[model samples]
Target: MSDETNNEGLNEAPWRATILTLYPDMFPGPLGTSLAGRALENGLWSLDILHIRDFAEGKHRNVDDTPAGGGAGMVLRPDVVGRAIDAATGEGDMRPRILLSPRGKSLTQEKVRSLKEAGGAILLCGRFEGVDQRVIDGRNLEEISIGDYILSGGELGAMVLMDAVVRLLPGVMGKVASGEDESFESGLLEYPHYTRPTIWEGHEIPEILASGHHGKIAQWRHEQAVALTKERRPDLYEAWEAEE
Candidate 1:
């Protein structure tokens, strides 16, 4: 990530982000690659990193402690984490503050689009068991989870969320419409994709794709998308049907 501060030349920044984590080095990790990296270099967005431990009171820089009630792991202290969040945001900052957690509302393409439209976000990457719930409630943090499984830390989840959102920002992707029909965008999984070498390993590409009939091709893609969604994700298929 850039050494540039979040408030650096505030007027010129198109998109801004601030990550609060115990492991600041993990940032810009994958975001520093491919489209996201290029966007960062082009100033399409700006990232600011904040280390949560910096707010800890003791010499050990202990940001977490044993859970109050009793648990297998530690919980981030509310006061320290709250201070970090306040440092990133001041009065009247409208950017949505997000916390990456397993129990959060599942992240969706619609949510990603909303975040992109906002042009910025403050992401909190929790470690240990989780953050003190008080900070989450007091800071008005929108908790978001990428999937059903768990990760070792929220840094990776934050990166995943950022990558998903950043690619949708203006000029990041080559074609704007390219993302519109992707998985979950239409409440259905995307259709299968095929390339040259029509026949590979004795498996032939779908005939409709090769028919050169634009209308039929479009119909075929829509049908395949529906079938795939219904087979792979019954929940999404049901929602799609309900919408229709």
Candidate 2:
């Protein structure tokens, strides 16, 4: 639990996130701005950062070493990372422990929702080559990948994951519908939106949107969402169709 004062005064516990990373300063980067930041201030959620280097021992304070069986880069030492994990999660903490890696399970909106329901997470950001496999296995860290591409480090992935989960926290967004109607929430890309201008350059807002009939507007939005999904993301469309 965080010591930060809660302005909202909610009786329930705030969602907690403990981040274990070599670069502790990278966190709450974008998370400290916008809706997520406001939520943090209101004590809807909390963030704790643990510097991996803090757990290193010896005069030089080394936290990584050359990979076993000969690899090109250094691997985070199992002993050091294990110690950090232990410190982050005291006895009997049920919150999921996650390791951000390219090889991990692909992250999705469904997974994000599950994490939010779990109330909190312990995130491990790997660097250099990667964390020692022994530590990853022994600690039972659930590996997660944000996308198929490679990143310089896992800090950005952790931020992305947190951003997705935090927005769904109670009172984070102004309206419940705001999060519900987003892309992937219903297995389709969201329909295009238009604003007061009504016309932008040569383009005009669809006439149906201006119509007052609620049923027709809902139907139009669903059709547009389906069409857009089929064109832009056939894979999602296929899965949605299968379930239907």
Candidate 3:
């Protein structure tokens, strides 16, 4: 619950988030503008980019150490990362901790919506090799990945997840309808949309779409969404069909 009540005496506060990363500057730029920026400016969501290097013990200020068993790259030390998370979360039991790792659960729009209801989470962006397993185990962090591929670091994935989650925060989106109408919102692909001209290069838009018969148009959209999903992503189509 939030303190700022509206004319209806309702206080719908935004989600509160804190990010623990070695590269703090990597986060504040794009994250500081657009929708996420507006959310921060409005206090709909709060983000603290706690630098893991700040907790480093000594000179060189190294947050990562060479792999113990003769591996390729240096892994992030648990001590530095653990300490940073502790500082931001204040040793509480309720704080949500997330490790952005490729081995974790696949991220989905439904999952994004669910995480929004959770009041945000702490995103741990792993660099170099990866964060020490001990930190993840000790903190009981949930690991989530955007897809099946690997990237240089978790920073991009963390940002993607944050953007998805934060936009759902109250007041973050200019129009709620916009988010609701996006792909995967209805467990199906978004209906085809066209702007202006209606006919470009002689590829005229579908006549049924422009017919304005609301019921027929809605049905056509549903069929298109289902058909598109089946053609493009049969896996999603399979899951959607199983439910029905």
Q: Higher TM-score: candidate 2 or 3?
A: 2
lDDT, candidate 1, residue 232?
A: 92
Tens digit of per-residue lDDT, candidate 3, span 44-134: 7778788888888987988888988897989999888888888878645365788899988999998898888887788888888788989
Candidate 3, position 114, lDDT: 84
For residue 238, give model 2's deviation from the true position in Å.
Answer: 0.8
lDDT per model, in order? 0.87, 0.91, 0.80
Best by lDDT: 2
At residue 229, candidate 3 shows an lDDT of: 91
Residue pairs of candidate 1 with colliding backbone atoms: none
lDDT (Cα, tens digit) per residue for candidate 1, span 1-244? 1222232322455788999999999879989988788878878888999999899897788898999878699999999999999999978889999999999999988898899888799999988899888998999999999999989889999998899988777667766567787888888899999998999999999999999999999999999999999999999999999989
Q: lDDT order of candidates, best first?
A: 2, 1, 3
RMSD of each: 4.8, 3.8, 4.0
- Model 3 C-alpha lDDT versus the unseen true structure: 0.80
Count clashes in each candidate, considering only residues at least 3 apart in sequence or on different chains: 0, 0, 0
